[model samples]
Target: MAKSKVYFTNLRASFGRNLLQKLEKLIKEAGIGNIDFQNKYAAIKIHFGEPGNLAFLRPNYAKVVADVVKELGGKPFLTDCNTLYVGRRKNALDHLDTAYENGFSPFSTGCHVLIGDGLKGTDETLVPIDGDYVKEAKIGAAIMDADVFISLTHFKGHEATGFGGCLKNIGMGCGSRAGKMEMHSSGKPHVNQQLCVGCGSCQKDCAHSAITITDRKASIDHSKCVGCGRCIGRCPVDAVEAASDEANDILNCKIAEYTWAVVKDRPCFHISLVVDVSPNCDCHSENDLPIVPDVGMFASFDPIALDQACADAVNAQPSVPGSILDERERCHHDHFTDTHPDTNWESCLEHGVKLGLGTREYELITIQ
Candidate 1:
């Protein structure tokens, strides 16, 4: 395959020009206008920073992307799926509240905020992609419903995937509760006996008769359970929990496959801002100091290439003075591996290339 084009622009500003303006110029120059957006429902996938996490991308940047979509005659909405782990964004109600509290309202972003998964994170659309790790991917309903998909990601370090870039943002970020459970764990969920109030809600929701309640507690029969994660959403007390025992390498591969499920047969665009280069995921309630200095913004039609470009750029930068990367013993030459010894982000990119998502080789064009 030919090298894909990834456009880039540094975070330099002058009078009457700012980072938002630069983002607009970068995407347009990267060929965002090539897509037919007229009358289309565009989903701009993004992470509304976890409550108290100050490292997430600002709402003002999202507004620029949404405004551009409107300019091209598309209806845009900011979206993200609920997290598998318990947090401020575990359910739609709490998710929306967090979005608003973090300044991602319809008024602020010039578009409505839609929690990809519905009320309890159970509303999903199963996408069949015969991947080595995943046979069928369960994605949030609202995300799959969009006519056009765009990933606006905050490029940063991740403990599991090494760095959360385009593929990470779209693949892992778009999965519904069950989808995430499938990606993170190789086993089925177990009921928390203490949280189960003898509520047969989980038992009633299981389609495969995999859940059984006895003595006011629920237990899952692994033989019958398909790991669809329905019981996790049905439990009133949030008792059903997925076991995250998958190794980091397998998890990265699964993330790539999930990404393929989302962008298949759709017009998808990707943009990543390598700013606030935090040492961990934005899912954390708090952020550590950036491992590297802010790089800039990148945009591409090919997400795999976009991620490769971003990762390469980040690795080239010097480590921040007092950040985690600075304190670590830099034996591995690679920043991400040195920061997160157990993770191999290249697994996701390699798997993505093999899956025909996009090429890892990219032509980085600087947008002045």
Candidate 2:
């Protein structure tokens, strides 16, 4: 197989040029213009960052991608699916508000914002993947509706999957609310008796009628629960939680499969910014100190290769003082594994490669 090519450009900029100018140059080098974007609906999949997270890609970067798509006559929109966890982005309305509050408004990015899942996060299209762990993936409707897909990822650490890269961004980030539930757990949510308010919110939102309120507490009939995860967001007190961490790993594997469902037939391009290197996922509203110095920006036609390259780059750099890595006596040689010892990021990439999503091997081309 031909090795995928990953292009890179460091943060250094000439007085006449800025990072945005360099981003455009990098995209052209990656051949993103080859896609037939004329008169097509282009979806620039991105994380707008939870309101307090400072590590997310700046809106200026999104503008560069949006502008390129529009110049190709494509109707570009910045998009991301609703979250499964109980947070500000749990639904479309609140998700949009969070996006705008973070400066990702249509006015800023030269495009509109559409929560991939609809009003309730259940608005999705089931895509069959025939994978080992997942047969079908529930993807957000708006994401599946687009003619083209582009990922703008903020490369960072993840507690479960080792690292958050292009695949994590597309696979985990693109799942609809129900799909996210499928990706994060093995079973339906369980009500913390102590936290349940007996408000019947879970029962009201459950389409399966699996939840019941009695004695001022919520109980779930596991057999009747479809594991839809709707109740996770509906609980007023955040009483509902997934089965366990084992289930979260299963959820991660399923997320990889779901990501395959999204990018399988699309002309895709990926860009990962290796700056603001947080120790946790961008899903967190608050970001911490970076673990390493700003490296550079990378673009690739292969998602897996791009991710692997980014991880390798981070691993090669010396750890930052007073950061998460500094707290440990011995630095972990593997970037993702060092941060998330239990997570095996390679598994996700290997599965992605086996699924023909992209290659793990690539030729890293430095643009600077």
Candidate 3:
């Protein structure tokens, strides 16, 4: 297939053209206006950042996207699925609180912030892809309900995926609890005995009789558990947890399939800012120093290509001194791989191409 166009702009800006202005110019030049967003609900998939994580993109960036959507006569809202982990973003209430705390209020970003899944992480839409690994994808209901989808990602390093780019932002970030469980784990979730208070919420919510309360402690029967991940969302105390045991390559493949399920049959666009460049996901409560210096912004209609371009951009830069990549052995000579040697970021893009998502081959069109 032919190469996709990935538009880019450097961080250098004059008083006449700020970074936000550059972002607006970049996406418009990259063909965001091609999508007919007239009076439609455009869901801007983004990570509001787990509370205390300063590596996430600031609300200013989100406003630029939201403003562009509104200028095109679309109703836009910033959104993210509640994280599966026991953090400030595990539930809708707490998620909103964290979002507002992190400067994502409507007053600031000029758009509402919606937790994609409902109060718990169980509100999902079952999208059937039937890929090699995932039979169906459970995506956040709010995300799938939108008329148009756009990913505004903070391109950064991840412990699992090597780097979390457009594909990871839309795929794993949009998955409901069960969808995330399928991507991250091969086995079912188990109860944390210490955290479990015998509330029976999980037992009551489980469609299968997999959980039992005994001696004020809860345990999961692996044989009986279907891995629906409902219990993980329903647990009042956040005791039920999914294991992160999936291989990196397999995890990347699953993430690609999940991404296919989300953007398929919709008008989707992507934009990733290659700043911060943290060594871990924004889901982590704390972030290490950036492994690479700030690159700039990249946007594309093809998410797979967008991701590939972002990875290439990161690898092209020299590793930052006094950062994690500097401290690691550079056997791979690739920034992402050197930072997280075990991760294979290419698998996601390759599998995405196999699924006819988009080609990894891209021509970077510098917008400056």
TM-score of each: 0.98, 0.95, 0.98
The lDDT values for all models are 0.94, 0.86, 0.93
Off by over 4 Å in 1: none
Ranking by TM-score: 3, 1, 2
Q: After superposition, how far is residue 152 of candidate 2 from its true place, in Å?
A: 0.4
**lDDT at position 261, candidate 3:** 95
Model 2, span 227-280: residue lDDT tens: 777887677688988774454456566767888999988788899999999989
lDDT of 3 by residue, 6-41 (tens): 999999999798999999999999988999999999
lDDT of 2 at 251: 53
RMSD (Cα, Å) for all candidates, in order, is 1.1, 1.6, 1.0
Candidate 2 Cα misplacement greater than 4 A, ranges: 247-252
Task: Give the clashing residue pairs of candidate 2, or none.
Answer: 183-251, 184-251
State the lDDT at 263 in candidate 1. Answer: 99
**Model 3 RMSD, rounded to 1 decimal:** 1.0
Off by over 4 Å in 3: none
Error of 3 at 70 (Å): 0.8
**Positional deviation of residue 302's Cα in model 1 after best superposition, in angstroms:** 0.9
Report the CA-based lDDT of candidate 3 relative to the real structure.
0.93
What tens-digit string does per-residue lDDT give for candidate 1 at 196-282?
898799889889998888898899999999888878877778898999999999999999999999999999999999999998999
